[model samples]
Target: MAIDPKSFEAIADLAYRESGLQLVVEKASMIQSRLRHRLKAVGTDSFASYAELVCSDEGLDERRQMISALTTNVSHFFRESHHFELLGQKILPGLIDKLRAGRRFRVWSAGCSNGQEAYSIAMTMLETFPEMAKMDVKILATDIDPKVVSFGRSAVYPERLTTGIPKNLKDKYFSVQKGKEGDEYTASEALKSLVVFKELNLLSNWPMKQKMDVVFCRNVVIYFDADTQDRLWPRFHSLLNSDGHLFLGHSERISEPSNAGFINNGPTSYRPIVAKR
Candidate 1:
């Protein structure tokens, strides 16, 4: 049965309030379609009932499930080649110097769907700075959806999904696993060891204590409103070390870069302005 307009609006509003994800009128049909499985899972015959349950005190977990269903998990290895290039060629060298000087290095892969982005960073770092495998280097990969976090922790993907991965990196960091369904590639232990996967909501309090050298939040803030985006810019700036980098999606920009204490260093890339002594 088609969802009533009232139920759709209520659910949309709830989604926005809870997750800061804007679901406009155009997305009503998409929302209904995605929530159908949740309806079945929750034993609801209609969207109205589902919406009521989601809004109730007892439905907190169901609300999380709803958000998980609504989130998009599309990602691939080396999805943005230029970002990795910048990391390997420009960013890693400076970080390597810090590492040699006895400082720890950290990279955060925010909204890292299914581990590809984090693994890609790991491969790049391991390939460029082989000595890092023995140093205090770690990549923190986080997503709001628990399922995707679990998927990332598994570090496994279908063979077709590995297309964007270069042959050299593929051979070096992944091993083939023959499954009944088809061929699957699992990230090597070396690559997996460098990453820690966690479930985190951007709207919630961040539990990380250490500052990051690089933060990849690409394609995430595009789902948020201008106000939410503006609020996040300063938070990210605070999370970074001196001269730390922030990378956004191709279509996303840090409105008022100077106000956010960031300088547009490259396309969709921002670096925090170093404070003068």
Candidate 2:
């Protein structure tokens, strides 16, 4: 059955409150289509019932499931190549020096979908600076959906999904196995070892105590409202170490960087504005 206007509004409100996803009336059909299976899974015959269950305090787990179903998880290895280039050329040199001085280099791949982004960072660092394998460095890859977090932790991808990975890197970093359908590639142990995948909601309290050197929250906040986006910029700023960089999706912008204690450093890149002592 189609989602009634009231139920759609209720679902939209819940999504906005829990995940900061803006579900507009225009995308009602898309939302309905995506949620059809959810109704069956929850044993609900109508959208109204599903909405009610998800909104109630007792429906916490169901709420998580609903958000997971509705979230868009499209990602590819090196989807935006320039960001990787910037990291290798501009960011890692300084971080390498710090690593040698007994500081841990940390990168957070927020909304890291299926682990491609975090793995890409690992592969790039391991390839460009081979000594990094022995260094104290880690990539924290997080997504709101537990399902995608599990997929990321697996560090396996099918042949089609491996295309975005460069030929040389693919050969160097992934082990290929022939599957019944085609081929599957698993990220090498070195790459997987540097990454930790966890389920996280951006709207919730972040648990990590260590500030990050680089945070890639690309393509995730485009779904949020202006107010939500504004609220997040400062939080990201607070989590970044001095001179640490934050990379957003190509289409997303902070509007005013200084307001968030950041200065525009590159295309879709911002660095925290450290105050002079």
Candidate 3:
């Protein structure tokens, strides 16, 4: 059954409040389609019933499931090549000295759906600085959805989902295995060792104690409203090292980067502004 206007609005508001996901009337059809499986999983064929369950205090877990169903998790290996190029060429070169001096180097793949982005970073790091295997280098890949986080931890991708990966990198970093879905490529242990996957809600308080050298939160904030986006900019600035980089989706931008204590360094890339002495 089509989601009635009332249930749709209720679910939309709930999604926004819980996860900062902006839901529009135009996307209601898409949302309804996505929620079909969710409704069935909850044993409800009616959108009204599903919404009622998900919106109640007694349905805390269902609320999470509803949000997960509503959110998009599209991802690809090195989805945007320029960001990786910048990392391999400019960013890593500067961090290499500090890393070799025993300082920890960390990267965050925020909203890292299914782990492709994190694995891409690992491949780039190892390919650029091979000795990082022995260094204190780690990539933290997180998503709000536990299902996607679990998929990331599995470190396996179907052959078709891996087209964005270059042939050389694929051969070097993934092992071929037979699967029900034809051939699957599992991340090599080296790549897996450098990445840690965790379930995280961007709207929730972050638990990371260390500042990151680079944070990749591409294609995520577009779902948030202006206020939500505004709040996130400063948080990202605070989480970054003085010389750290923040990469947003090509379609997303901070309204006034300097206001967020950031200065644009490259396409969709921002660096924390250092204070004048």
Candidate 4:
């Protein structure tokens, strides 16, 4: 049976309240389209019954699967290209010139949906820092959805995934796969080896044992409420090294009180006062 609009929106609201996901009222149609496939898979029809199943503790795994389907994970190579450019130009040179001898550089890619963003950074590093190949450069890529994280770790993408990736890079890094029905250019093992993907929820315990140098958290925090953002920013700031940088989504900028004592390094970039010193 086709679900009524009211029940669908109500369930979306439920997900929003419980999970901190903010699907706009207009996205109700998309939620229906996506979740309905899961409905068919489970041989369930009514949205209320499905919502009940999702809300049940015994149905936790089923609920996670539903989230995987309903949430859109549309990502591509070199998203917000300027950030990488800034990294190569402004950040890397400085770090190399003024680093503790043989120091390791650590990076964190939060909401690293399918690994494109993470690998893109790793690719830039490999291209820029050939001399430092012996130096440690670890990129910890994480996202809330395990299904997508595992998929990303596979480093496979259809042609659409490379739309934002540069032509020169496509020739050098990825190999073409004609027979695959998904993304045309799969991330080569050379690039995939540089990134480590993990299932992480930004709202919960981070489990990261060390601080990071650069943090890429684009296109994510919009899902969080103000209070949640308020809480998470300080945690991110704390987790960063004194001289580390935090990159927000293009549309997601941090403000004072929530992000006080941070320098306005660039439009989409910020550095804690501790870093500026």
Highest-lDDT candidate: 3
Per-residue CA lDDT of model 4 for 1-277, tens digit only, reads: 5567666766677666555677676776777787888887777878877877777787678777876776568678888888999888889988985543777789999999888899889888878876554577788999878888998888877786667777888888899878557547777776777789998878778898899999999988877777767777888888888788899888887767335556768878988776323
> What value does the lDDT take at residue 66 in candidate 4?
75
Q: C-alpha displacement of 11 in model 2, angstroms? A: 0.5
Model 2 lDDT per residue over 129-175, tens place: 89898899999999999999999999889998786998999999999
Model 1, runs deviating above 4 Å: none
Ranking by lDDT: 3, 2, 1, 4
Cα lDDT tens digits, model 3, 194-228, are: 99999999999999999999999999999999999
Task: Let me know the TM-score candidate 3 reaches against the reference structure.
Answer: 0.98
Which stretch of 10 consecutive residues in model 4 shows the poorest summed lDDT?
A: 255-264
After superposition, candidate 2 runs with Cα above 4 Å error: none
Alpha carbon lDDT of each predicted model: 0.90, 0.92, 0.93, 0.79
**Worst lDDT 10-window in candidate 3:** 62-71
TM-score of each: 0.98, 0.98, 0.98, 0.90
TM-score-better candidate, 3 vs 4: 3
User: What tens-digit string does per-residue lDDT give for candidate 1 at 1-277?
Assistant: 7888888888888888887899887777787788899999989798888989999999999999999999998889888789999999999897677798888889999999888999999998988888988899999999999999999999888887787998888887889989767999999999999999999999889999989999999999999999999999999999999878999988999989989899998999999999899
